[model samples]
Target: MNTLLLIEDDHRLANMVSEYLQQSGFTVQHAANGLDGLKVLQSTAPALVLLDLMLPDIDGLEVCKRIRALPGALAQTPVLMLTAKGDPMDRIVGLELGADDYLPKPFEPRELLARIRAVLRRHAPGEATEATHQTLKFGSLELDRDARSVSVRGDVCDLTAYQFDLLWVLAERAGRVLSRDQIMEAVRGRELEAFDRSIDVHMGRIRAAIEEDAKAPKRILTVRGVGYVFAKQQD
Candidate 1:
């Protein structure tokens, strides 16, 4: 079972969420404050983190920053911010700072569950199936498995860990259309419940790094109603 670390101050809310998620097949651990949540995360690395923005000791944004700074812990863990702050600016800031998804309070249980599954799907590791590719290439783009680096036209592009992983998955199966869920499974190695935009945004960043014209991308093509595909050849 996938372990989840939840940081929320409201006991009633925590209990409710813990019970519901447990019933949905996750092992949930609850912390009432940011500090306590951080401690628990340090000791036990959960598959995903559900963080409430209104923590008592520290704000959830600060907690997220601190976690990103931690040595080797949560560096790649997907964080979903749960808050009542529904402003557009708040969501943008959270995403910019690496929060995978934001769920406002008063959300439906079904929506929350979907978001959780999306996040987990994005972060879960790739399967150890015999069909998985060890390396993938497209035109001048290359994803080096041993180095975990992305190279375009033989020049290395500075990519974040998540960015590289996303590109690597897309490039490895060039021309193949992959749904958001399929891409998430290949890249994240788990399941994601809600933050599917992370994949799109990260793909945009990767294209900006490689494409000659990001505004009119030629290599990474978006299929309407479908997911995304890395074009084997430029249009």
Candidate 2:
């Protein structure tokens, strides 16, 4: 069973979520605060982190930032944020901080479970048979599906697991203009939150990593009023 580290302060909510997830076949380690969560992370590597945006001590956004600063592969650990606020900005900020996904506080247990599964699937490597087409190239940019790594001109690029998947989806269908709905559909392989504009934020993050100049992105271009397309030719 996959393990999940939940950094939430509400005792009642925590216990309920823990019980719900446990019933779904996941092992959950709960931390009441951000520091404790970091401590737990240091001792154990969970498949993913379920972070609450508001905490008694340090906020979840700060925790997410620190997680990304961790050494090596640990920094790439998938994060699914829980936001009590209905503000779209909170979700956008979490996404900017490398969160794989986010669900508003009043979320149904079933939706939460589905979201967790989807995030985990994105972080995990594809099936063994897909290894034949594992590495994708676009001039200087290279993506290794098996390694879940991206590099530009042999130099590695820093990207969240979710961002990498988004880029990979576009790259695999290079030259095709994909609507935001289509892109998310292809990436998740399941129904998700409707065509959220936050996808633009993720695209910006991906370009900042792999593109020499995010201002003049060449690899991924927006078609205006439509969606984005990964360029076939690159230099």
Candidate 3:
């Protein structure tokens, strides 16, 4: 059974969600505050976490940061945020803080369940085995799957987990162009909103990190009306 630690201060909602998830065959553990949630996570080592941004003690973002810093098998566990805040900025911040996905408050139970399943689908064991986890190189740029890290000319660069996933998707498909929607779904594990520019925003940051000069980028080339391509490396 997939164990999920759900952290939410709203007792009624927590109970409802916990019961619903349990019915869906998930082993659900509930926490009423961020600190307790973190403690549960450390002790129980759940498969995933469902975190609410508002909590009685410490905010969910802090909990996420602490989890990201945790040593051993817990560090890479995916977190799916549940927040009353529906703003795009809030969602982006959650993603930056290592959240795998976010479901706004007033969410339908069905939608929440779907998001949980999607998260599991994306990170489940044997999923990425479709391609070997070996490092891939394009000129001076190297993507190290084993390290879950990237480097440009031997210098490791910082990237948000989302950013790293996006770069990896494009790099692995080097020379093949991917549409914005396709890229968004592959990287974010969700479809993009009509007005959402989150993918573009992430792409810009990625170019800044890897391109010699983000302003005059030759790689990550833009193809108007289509999308961006991880421009093929030249010998």
Candidate 4:
């Protein structure tokens, strides 16, 4: 059973969510606040985290940052953020903070379950659809599919599980400019919200990690009104 950690201060909601997830064949660990959630994370090592933006201690954004700072594989643990319904800013910020996905509050249990499964699938190692070759090289930059790691000149680049998948999609199709919808379809297969900028945010994070100069990126180039393309050659 895949264990999951839920960090929500509301006991009633947490109980309901935990019960629902338990019925869905998941082991649920509930934490009421950010600090407790971090502690539970270290002890439980859940497959994913369901983080609530509003916490009694540090907000979910801070917790997300802290999680990304953790050592080793733990730092790449999938994060599914929960934000207030209709609060697009919080959801965008959550994604910018390295969340794999976000489900706005007061969401249907089924949708939550679907989102969780989707994020987990994207982070799963060595899926059959993965390229036969385990690694790809672009000049000094390297992407190791088996390790789910990216490095430039032997220096590891920090990226969230989602960002890694996003980068993988672009790197695998180097020299091709892909629209936002195409990229999303290849990665998570989620419907883009009207005026949604989540993909752009993830791309910004990816560029920050891999590009020598994010503001004047040479590896990943924006097509202005179109989308983005990973440069075929890099140094």
Best by TM-score: 2
Q: Which pairs, if any, clash in model 3?
A: none
Which sections of candidate 2 miss by over 4 Å? 127-133
| Model 3 CA RMSD to the hidden true structure, in angstroms | 3.6
- Candidate 2's displacement at residue 207, Å, is 0.9
lDDT string for model 4 (1-235, tens) is 3999999999999999999999999999999999999999998899999999999989999999999888877888899999998888888888877898898879899889988898898788875345575888999999988778899999999887778888999999999999887887787646543335688888999999888889999998999998999998757
Task: Please give the lDDT score for candidate 1.
Answer: 0.76
Off by over 4 Å in 1: 128-131, 138-141, 144-235
Task: Give lDDT for model 3.
Answer: 0.80
- Write down the RMSD of candidate 2 (Cα, Å): 1.6
| Ten-residue region with minimum lDDT total, candidate 4 | 188-197
After aligning candidate 3 to the native by TM-score, how far in Å is the CA of 158 from where it should be?
6.5
- lDDT per residue (tens digit) for residues 77-195 in model 1: 77888978456555555655667677888777777878888767655555544565466666677776655667788897755555666777787788899888888777653353334
- Model 1 TM-score, 2 decimals: 0.66
lDDT of 2 by residue, 1-235 (tens): 3989999999999999999999999999999999999989878889999999999999999999999999977788889999985678888888888898888989999999999998888888766565375888989899999788899989998888788989999999999999998998888744766667888989998988988899999999999999999999968
Provide TM-scores for the models.
0.66, 0.95, 0.79, 0.92
TM-score of 2: 0.95
User: Model 2 shows how many backbone clashes?
Assistant: 0
Error of 1 at 182 (Å): 13
Q: Which regions of candidate 3 are displaced past 4 Å?
A: 127-135, 144-165, 185-196, 201-226
- For candidate 1, the 10 contiguous residues with the lowest summed lDDT are 188-197
Better of 2 and 3 by TM-score: 2
- The lDDT for every candidate, in the order shown, is 0.76, 0.89, 0.80, 0.88
